[model samples]
Target chain A: MRARFWIVASLGLAAAALLGVALGPVGLSPAAVWAALAGHGDTTTVTIVQAIRLPRVALAALVGAALGMSGAAMQGTLRNGLAEPYLLGVSGGAAVGAVAAIAFHWNTVVGVPLAAFAGAAGAAALVLTIARIAGGRADVRLLLMAGVVVGAFANAAIMVAYATAPPESVRGALWWMMGSVDGAEWQRVTWLAAYVVIGGGALIVWARDLDALALGDDGAAALGVDVERASRRAYLAAALLAASTVAAAGLVGFVGLVVPHMVRAAGLRQYRTLLCGAAIVGAALVISADVVARTVRPPAELPLGAVTALLGVPFFLFQLRRLAARS
Target chain B: MTAAIEFRDARVRYAGAGGLAVAGVTFAAQSGNITAVTGPNGSGKSTLVKALLRRVPLAGGDIAIGGVTLGQMSLRDAARRAAVVPQREEPAFPMTVREYIALGRFPYASVWSTSDPGGDRAVTAAVERAGVGGFLERHTDELSGGEWQRVRIARALAQGGRLLVLDEPTTFLDVGHEMAVFELLAELARDGMGVLLITHQLNLVARFAQHVVLLHAGTIAAQGPPNAVMTGGILERVYDWPLVVARDPAVGAPMLIPLRAPSPVTVHRPMET
Candidate 1:
C-alpha cells in the first residue's frame, strides 16, 4: 500500500513537470518535450527546454518539496493541523531578509538566502521566547498570535526599506514580495536544493520525535524523546526550508498549508509518508498553479502565489469541514 | 533493596510565581505495590508527578531512582526505567491504535534501525495485555474514552519500563471504566511493576491502592496505608467538611459519605480574564 502511494506521488510529480514545461507561451507536444529534453530537437527548442523550461520546472518542484516538508514539520511540532510555514511568520521573515539585501545592494545569490535565513532564525527565536514567557509552550494560540505580530513587524520593516530604495529597485522588491519563479536559474536551484535536502531529510529522519510529540511535551519527554532539543532543531529546519524557498522563488503561499492536508486526507499518519506525499503533491500543486499563472492570459503572468491559494483553498476548506465533523 | 522511585524532600515552584507548587514532598513508590497521591484541587499532586519525571524543575531537593539520583541520568535512561500515562490523549493528527502503541519503541529505535520486528513484537504484546486487540487498527478519535485510555496504557506498557506513573488517568471515564482502569493498574502492580497513580477518587484508592499520600496546599498532609489515611479526621479537615467513613458492603474498602457541610462549598474564584 505504501509503495503504491509512493509510485503515485512520484508519477504525479513527473507528469506535472512535463505538463508545466509544455503549457507555456510556446506550447510543445509530449514527443517534442521528450525530444528537447534528450537534446535531439532544433536549437531554439533545445535552448527553450534546457535553459528556460527546465530550470523553472526544477525550481517549482524544489520549492514545493521544501515548503511542503516544512509544513508537515510545523504541524507535527506545534500539533496543530492548520500550522504552516508562512502562517508561523517564516516567509515574512525571509521577505524581510531578501528585501533588506536587495535594497542595500547586497543582493548576491549567496547573500540573499543567508540574510533570509537569518531573518527566519530571528522570527523563530521571537516566537519561542514569547511562548516561553507565556509559561512554556502555554497554548498554540499564543504562538500563532505571536507569529502574526512578528510577521506584521517584519512587513513594516520591509516597507521602510522599500521606501528608502531607488525606484528601479522598488519594482524588483515588489516582485520578490509577490512570489514568482520567472527568475529561476541553474546556479540558484543547486544551492536551494542543498537547503531543501538538509532540512527536509533531517525532519524525515526525526519522525519518531514527531510521533512522541502526539502525546504532548511532558508525555513526549516520558517517551524518551529529547523534546527540547529535537523541537528546536525541527523549528530551525522548518525555518530554513521556508526561507530557502523564498530565496529561490518568492513567497509561494498555500503549498505548505495545502499539501500536508492532502497527504493526511489520503490517510497517511507517519511523518515519513507525510513528508514524501507532501513533496510530490506539493510539487504537482505548484507546477500546475504556475502553469495556470503563466498561461491564463497570453504573454501576461499572474502572481504564482495567488494562483496556488486560488487552486488550494477549496481543498483546504473541504478537509477542514471533514476534520470538524470528525471531532 | 532500594525502592523503585524515591523522593528526597522534592520541591517545585513556578518561576516568578507567588507560591511553590510542590513543597518538600518526600515519598517512595515501592515495586509490586500501587501508590496513590490524593489531594484537594489546590494541592500539588500533579506537580509531584511532574517533578519526579523532571518535566518541571525541582526548586530544591533531589529525586533518586533505585538509589541513583535522577540528575545524573539521561532522558533515554530515565524513560527506559519509567513511563507515564496522562489524563487525556489529544493527537493533532489521526493515528491508528497500533501505530500509537508502536511509538513506545521510539526510545529503543535509532536512525539506522528500520522496520523493527522487535518494536512490532512489543506493540503486539502490549495491545494484548491491555485487552485492546479488537481496536488495534482503529483510529484513536474513533475509540471511546475507556478504550482510548487503555490504548494509552498499552503504549506506556510497550515502552518496557519498570515504573508506571499515571496522572489522574480516570478524569474523563465513567464509573465502570474508572473501576476497570484501577483494576488494570492493580494488576500491573501485582505483576511487579511500580505503579504511581494521582487521583481524587478516594473510594477507588481505598479499594485498589496499597499506599496513599494525602496532599494539602502543596505539602504532604499524611501518608500511610489507605485504611489509616482514609479516616474521617484527615479527610474532613483537609476538605473542610463533615463526612462519614464506612467499610464497603462487599469488600473492606473505606468509602466516604458527606453528612452536611458547615457552609456551602465556596464557588471557584473568578479570574481576571
Candidate 2:
C-alpha cells in the first residue's frame, strides 16, 4: 500500500508537471515542453512556460496540497467527517487579512501574502480562544461552533471592507477575494512550497495522535496520550498550512472542505494516507477546475472561485441529499 | 497487601457548592475484594468514586492507589493503576466494539506511534472474557443498553489495572442484564481485581458486594459487611421513611420494602432551647 501510494503520487506530480507545461495560450507540444523544461527550446516559448505558466501551476499544486493535508489533519483532530481548514475559520480569517491589507494599501513593505498569513493566524487564535472561553474543552462541537461564529464575523468584516472601499481598489481587492492563481510568481510559490512541506510533514508524523483522538478524550488519555497537547499541535499545524495556502493563492474555497470528505467517503481513514490522498486529489481537482475556468472564456478570465462554486454546489447538493437519504 | 484504592479523609467539593460532596471519607478497597459504595440519591456516592479516580478535584485529604498518592502520580500513571467506567457516559464515536475495547490500551500508546500488538491481544481476550465476543464487530453505539454496559466492562477489563471503578454500571440495564453484569464483577474479583462500584441497587449490592459503604449528605453514614449495614434502622434514617429489610430465601440476599412514603408529621412540638 505504501509503495502504491508513492507510485500514485509520483505519477500525479509527473502528470501535473507535464500538463502544466503543455497546456497554455502558447501551447508547447509534449516534445517541446520537455525540451523547454530541459533548457533546449526557443526563447519565447521557454520564457512563457518558465516565467509565466509554470509558476502558476506550481503555486496551484503547492497550495492545493497544503489545503488538502490541513483539511485531513483538521478532520482527524476533531474526529469529525466535516471538519476542514475553512471550518476552523483560517481561510475566512486569512481572507479578512488579505482584503484588509489590500484595502488599506499595505502592499509596499511585506505584501498581501504576509498580511494574509497574519490574518489567518489571528482568525485561528480568536476561534480557539473563544472556544476555550466557552469551556467546550476543545470538544469537536465547540470548535465547529467557534469556526462558524468566527467565519461569519470575518465575512461581515470583509463585506464592510468591500462595501466601503474606494472604487479603484475594489477591482483589485475583488480579484484577490475571488481567488486567482493567475499572477503567481516563483518567489510566492517557493514560500508556499516550504510552508506546505513543513506543516504537512508535521501532520503526517502526528498521524497516530489523530488515531488516539478517534477514541475520544478519556480513551486517548488512557492510552498515554496527552490529549490536549496532541490536539493543540494538530490545530496549529492545520492553521499554519491553511494560512499559507490563502497567502499564496488568495481565498480558494471548497478545495479544503471538499477534498478531505471525498477521501473519507472513499473508505480511507488513516491520517497519513488520508492526508496524502487528499493532497493529490485536491491538487488535481483544483487544476482541472482552473483548466475549465480558463478555457470557458477564450480571451477573458473568470473568477476561479466562481468556477469552484459552480462545480462545488452540485457536489455539495449531492452529498447533502445522500446524507438525508441515509438518515 | 496494600489496598488497591484508599480514600483518606477524602473530600470532593464541586464548584459553586459550599460543602464537600464526600466529606472526610476514608475507606480502603482491599485487593481481591469487591467494595460497593451505595447510598440514597444525592448522597455523594458518585462523588467518592470520582475523587478516587481524580476526575473530580478533592477539596481536602488524599486518594491513593496502591499507596501512591493520586496527586503525586501522573494522570497517565494513575490511569494505568485504575480504570473508571463513569455512570452512563456514552461513547460518541462510531467505532466498532473491538475498536472501542482497544481504546483501553491507549495509555500505553504514544502520540506518534502505532498501537502495541500485545495490547490488541489483551483487548480481544478481555472482550471474549466479558462475554461480548459475539458482538465484537458491531458498532458500539448500535448496541443495546445491556450489551453496551458489557462492552464498557470489556474495556475496563482490557485496561489491565489493579482496580476497576464503576459508577452505576447497571443504570439502564434490565434485571437479567443487571444480574449478568454482577456475576461478571464477581468473577473479576475472584480473578484478583479489586472492584469498587457506586450503585443505587441495594438488593444487588447486598447479594454480590463483599463490602458496603453507605453515604448520606456527602459523608460516610455507615461502612461494614452487607449483613451489618442493611439494617432497618439505617435504611429508615438514610431514606427519611419507614422501611423493612429482610433476607430473601432464594438468593440469600437482603431486600428492602418501603413501608410508607414520607408521611409528614401531623403535630409540631415547641422548639427546644
Candidate 3:
C-alpha cells in the first residue's frame, strides 16, 4: 500500500512538472513540448522552452526539494512539528550572507552563488553558535528566538545596502529580493542539484537515526543512538541544503515548513519515503506556483516568495489549529 | 564475581531555578539480580537512572559498567551493555510499531549492515517477550497507554543489552499489565541480565525485586531486600504520612497501608463515661 501511494504521488508530480513546462502565455502544445524535449524545435521555440522556461522549472524543483527534505530532518531532530529551515535561522543567515555579497558587489568580482554560499554558511554558523551559547542542546526555544532576531537583523541589513547602492544595483537587489526565477540560468540549477543530491543522499542514509530521534533525546540515546552526534550531523546537513537553496533562489519562505507536513499527513512516515515524496511534491508545488505568478497578469510577474505564502498560509493555519486541538 | 553495573558516588544535580535534586547517590547491580530504586515523588529516583546512563552528566562522581568508567566507553558501547525504558515517551512523528521496535537495533547494526534473517529473528523474539507481538503493524500513537508502555519495553528488550534500566515502567499500567511487565523483567534477570527498575509501585517491587534501594530527600534512606527495607518507620518518614507495612498472608510479600488523618470535633466531650 505504501509503495502504491508513492507511485501515485510520483506520477502526479511528474505530470505537474511536464504541465508546468508546457503551459505559459505563449502556450506550447503537448506536441511542441515533446518536440522541444526531443531536441527538434525551432530556435525561438527552443529558447523559450530551454533557456527561459526550462532552467526556471529545474531551479524550482531543486530548491523546493532541498527545502522539503531539510525541513523533515530539522523537525525530526528537534522533535518539534513546527520546525522549518527558516525557523532555525538557516534561511535568515543565508539571506544575510547573500545581501552582504550584493551590497559589496561581490558578484562582479567573485561570482553570484559563491558570495551567497559564503553568506549562508556564515549565517548558519552564527545561529548554531548563538543557540549553543544561550541554552545548550535543550535550548530549542531560545534558538528559535535567536533565529527571529537574526532574520530581522539580516533584512534590515539588506535594506540598508539597497538604500546605499547605485540605482542599477538597487533594481537588481530589489528583483532578487522579490524572488523571481525570471533569469534563472543553468548555473544556479546545476550547483543546487549537486548540493541537494549529496545532502539529500546523506539524509536518506540517516533515516533510521532520524526515527530514533523522534522518541526524544533521552529515549533515542537509550536506544543506542549517539544523540549529540546524530543531531549535529543532521543539523549540519539540513543547514547546507537550506543554505544552498537560499543562495540560489532568494528567500522562498515556508516551502520547507509546508511540504514535509503535507507529505506526512498523506501518510508517508519513513524518512526515505518522506524525503523522496516531499522532494517531488515540493518541486511540483513551486513550479506550479511560479507558473501562476507569471500567468496571473500575463507577462507581468508576482514575486515567487509571495506565491509560496499564498499556498503556505492557509495550510499553516490549518495545521496550527489541528495541533492545538490535538494537544 | 562481576557486577553488570556499578555507581560509585554517582551524583546528578538538576540546576533548576532552585538547586539540585540529587546530592550523592551510589549503588550497584549484580548479574542475575533484580535491583529496584523506590522513593517518594521528589526523591530523585529518576535522577539515579539518568546518571547511570549518562543521559544527564554527573554533577560530582563516576559511574562504571563492567569495571570500565562510563566516560571511557562510548555512548554506543554503554548502550550495548545497558538499555533504558523510560516511564513515558512522546514521538513527534507517527511511526509503525515494528519500525519503532526495530530502533532497538541501532547499537547492534551499522548503517550499511544488511538485514539478515538473524536480525529478524532477534526482533521477533523481543516483540514476543515484551508481549506486543500482536500489535507490530499498528501506529504507535494509536496504542493505549499500557500498550505503548509495553511497546517501549519491548524496544529496550530488543536492544539485547545485559543491563536494563527502567524508570517507572509500570506508571500507566493496570494490575495485569504491570505484573506482566514485572514477570518479564524477572524472567530476563533469571537469564543473567541485571535489571535496575525504578518504580513507585512498592507492592510490585516488594513482590518481585531481589534487592531494593529506598531514597528520601535526595539521599538513600534504606537499602536491602524487601523484608529489610519496607519498614513502617522508613515508609512514613520518606512519604511524610502515617502508614503500615506488613507481610501479605496470601503471597508472602510486603503490603503498605496509609492511615488517614482524623477530623477535628467541635464538641470535645471525653468518650469514657
Q: Which one is best on DockQ?
A: 1
Give the docking tier of candidate 3: medium
Q: Taking the candidates one at a time, how many backbone clashes does each contain?
A: 0, 4, 2
Any runs in candidate 3 off by more than 4 Å, and if so which?
A: A87-89, A108-154, A170-178, B13-23, B59-61, B66-68, B113-117, B261-273
Best candidate (score: lDDT)? 1
Q: What share of the true interface contacts does candidate 1 keep?
A: 0.67
Could you list the iRMS of every candidate?
Answer: 1.7, 3.5, 2.0
Q: What C-alpha RMSD does candidate 3 show over the true interface residues after superposing them?
A: 2.0
How do the residues A1-327 of candidate 3 rate in per-residue lDDT, one tens digit apiece?
667767877787787777777878788888888788777879877888888788989998888889899888888888767678776666766776666666667753235455655665666667667878887644656666777677777677777777778766543554545466767889778878988998899998988788778888778878767788898788778877887777787777778889898898787886777888888888887887888888899878888878987887787678767667767
Worst 10 residues of 3 chain B by lDDT: B264-273
TM-score, one value per model: 0.94, 0.82, 0.89
lDDT by residue for model 2 over B1-273, one digit each (tens)? Answer: 798899899888898888777779888898788899987888888777656555568988998899989878876687778888866454423557886787787666665555665887888789888999998889765899999989988988887887898889898789999999999999989989999988989888898888999988878888999989999999889877678998787887788877744545743433421
Which digits, one per residue and each the tens of the lDDT, describe model 1 over residues A125-146?
8876887787665466677777
Clashes of 2: 4
| Fraction of native Cα contacts reproduced by each candidate | 0.67, 0.30, 0.71
Show pairs that collide, candidate 3. Answer: A94-A120, A97-A119
DockQ of each: 0.65, 0.30, 0.52
Candidate 2 C-alpha lDDT tens digits along A239-283 = 878877776666677677688777665645557677888888778
Any idea what lDDT model 2 has?
Answer: 0.77
